[model samples]
Target: MTIAKGDKIPAGKLRTLTADGPKDITTDEIFAGKTVVLFGLPGAFTPTCSAKHLPGFIEKFDALKAKGVDTIACVSVNDAFVMGAWGKSQDAGDKVLMLADGNADFAKSLGLDADFSAYGMGTRSKRFSLVAKDGVVTEVNVEAQGAFEVSTADHVLGQL
Candidate 1:
């Protein structure tokens, strides 16, 4: 089932590119003792994601932090390299954490995996966003296929 509000996020390893190289980041490390805004997309550099979803978060980074969010992270099924490159191209800088769920482990754990084989993209994540406080979810907004309403940064900011 899809992870719901008040659910404890499942354990999984995600990757993020750093100055030294790719590094493993655990779910606990991300959510424990923090108020985090984590948004997931189908893939990196895809049209909707690049044009709207990710940019919304970037543009609202300060507003999110102002609302007491400790971190704002963007997750995708792509590898760390692509995530890193996309972040650079988007000028994400330190405002957003680019997390790579390369194996879809995190997505599956949350029951948010979507098959895109018909589009030749294979397995990917559904568009979604959540607010987690100290490892337990407080709010969740999952988008329907081809929709972008609830997962936008403005929506999450309004919730906050």
Candidate 2:
């Protein structure tokens, strides 16, 4: 089932590129004892994600942190290398954690996986965002099919 408010984040391993190389990070490692804002997009470097979704979070980093969010993460169905490069290109720096769910395991586990075969993208993540404290969700913002309003940073900020 799709994860919702009050749901604990599922257990999973995601990849991130560190200064040394790709590292494995578990969901628990990320959300444990912290307030996390996790957002997912269809893919990296795609139109909406590149232009708005990701940038919106970067722009609102301080604001989100001010509201007690410990981490703002952008996860996609891409690999570690791509995620790293995309973050660098977007000047994400330390503002957002770029996570790669490579096979969509995390997305599928959340029931937020989307089929984009028509676009030749195969299985990917639907646009969504959620807030969790120590792993239990407090709010979930999932965008409607082909829509982008609900999951934007500004909207999520308002919810906070």
Candidate 3:
């Protein structure tokens, strides 16, 4: 079942690019005891992702923080190296947490995976965002195909 409002994020292992190096972060560790704005994309550096989605979060990091958001994260099915590079390219500059779901484990657990094999992208994450507080989902927003409607930072900040 897809995780929803009031549902606790499931325990899953994933990698994050940290200052020290690649590090492991469990689902529990991500959403536990904090208000997190997490957005997922089909892939890093894809047109919409780089042009709009990720940039919105990068520009609004301070605003989100001012509104009491603890952590703002961007996640993709790509590996940590790709995610880290994308973050730097976008000038995310440590303003947001970038996570790699290289195995698609977390995406599958959330019932969200894009069938991009038609485009040779293989399995990927659907564009979406969620607000989780103390490990439970409080809000969820998913974009329509080829649309960047509800997953942007403005939409999520409104929910907060």
The TM-scores, one per candidate, come to 0.99, 0.99, 0.96
TM-score of 3: 0.96
- Give the per-residue lDDT digits (tens) of candidate 2, residues 1-160: 9998999999999999999999999999999999999999999999999999999999999999999999999999999999999999999999999999999999999999999999999999999999999999998989987899999999889989
lDDT of each: 0.96, 0.96, 0.90
lDDT of 1 by residue, 1-160 (tens): 9999999989889999999999999999999999999999999999999999999999999899999999999999999999999999999999999999998999999999999899899999999999999999999999999999999999999999
Tens digit per residue, CA lDDT, model 3, 66-150: 9889999899999998999999999998788889999899998988787889989999999999999897899999888888889
Q: Which parts of model 3 have CA positions greater than 4 angstroms off?
A: none
- Sorting all predicted structures by lDDT, with the top scorer first, yields 2, 1, 3
Count of clashing residue pairs in every prediction? 0, 0, 0
In candidate 1, stretches whose alpha carbon ends up further than 4 angstroms from where it belongs are none
Pairs that collide, model 1? none
